[model samples]
Target: MNSQIKKHQACYTVADYMSWPDDERLELIAGQIFDMSPAPSIKHQNITGEFYSQLKQKLKGKSCVPFIAPVDVVLSANDVVQPDVLVVCNPDKITEKNIQGAPDLIVEVLSPRTALKDLREKKLLYERSGVQEYVIIDPLEEYVQRCWLQNDGHYGASEIFGSPEALALQSLPEVELPLWEIFGLEPPEPAIIWSG
Candidate 1:
């Protein structure tokens, strides 16, 4: 241990994260800064795109707003995160810079590098911030796990959904979608061989 070596402190606030120059892909978790991985895989994008497409059609003229990734969701001044998908009905809450307050729904598409963080860190943050619903999307297993914030806590009454089931949301009642559609990928063909 060298006396001159000093560890860099983690960022705990949205302002702390936003202060950095562009090109830093990071998220603030309960006053801690975690470096995010690169872009998502093709499968991740496909599902996100598919879900966004459906939500757009279903949520038309509705109060529930459907938004995709790259949009900052500020849980608090000190806690700002960019969830994969977020819906905010309060137009007044949507600020010119970022989401000023908690949204109705927060969605996260899990990746290899972000699985643990998404399941634990992000989940805790969303719950504490009062997000109505938090969705954890796993493209690897083609599953979408929805975590409803009940009793002001997380990981309770969480629903894990798989194929043949449609996603239902209390915030967006018009959201009607099938599992196969969200994957938006063609199934593998049955193995066959030329028989004599």
Candidate 2:
């Protein structure tokens, strides 16, 4: 291998990652840098916002806190990521700067720009980092799949949910998200009706 390439592959730590320019988005996985570009689509943003709002509403006055994107979750010195949505039940792991460890539940909304990495690399990273649950949302397909960390420290079989049913968070069963509402397929029940 060439010296320049080898030098670049020497595995950057969290300190190195923090020192880089923030003009564009990037992720660090296993000491490798992955560029996040092309910006998110409208559907992706909408889906992310829906999930965040629902989760935030459910977690109100609760120990578990929900965070949206651009919040750094530091999995390791060599691995850091910004999940679309993350819920942390453990207060100690959270700090003003970033999450110091794995969150209880993490959600990533799929886009053409990040589908592969979110499913493959980020999946493995979260599993290894001891995240209790990982959810992948495909906005275009209107499907959500989740995998829970098994007792053996690996992810269990995936549970897929499509339109027509609300998504029940295994980590937070009390919180049920109406998928149809989130995807904007069905109108929310009318709050009130006036008859004169």
Taking every candidate in turn, the Cα RMSD to the unseen true structure, in Å, is: 6.3, 5.6
Clashes of each: 2, 0
* Model 2 CA deviation exceeding 4 Å by range: 1-7, 187-196
TM-score of 1: 0.85
- Please provide, for model 1 over 1-196, each residue's C-alpha lDDT reduced to its tens digit, 9 standing for 90 to 100: 2222223765356666776655656676777766675788988888888788888888889877788888877777677788888889899888888888889988888899888999988888888888888888899888888888777465477898885577888667667678778876554455689999
Q: What TM-score does candidate 2 reach?
A: 0.90
- The C-alpha stretches of model 1 lying farther than 4 A from their native spots are 1-7, 152-155, 185-196
| Candidate 2, 86-166: lDDT as tens digits | 999999999998999999999999988789999999999999999999999988888889999999999999999986678
| Candidate that scores best on TM-score | 2
**Lowest lDDT block of 10, candidate 1:** 1-10
Candidate 1 Cα deviation (angstroms), residue 104:
0.7
**Alpha-carbon lDDT, every model:** 0.78, 0.89
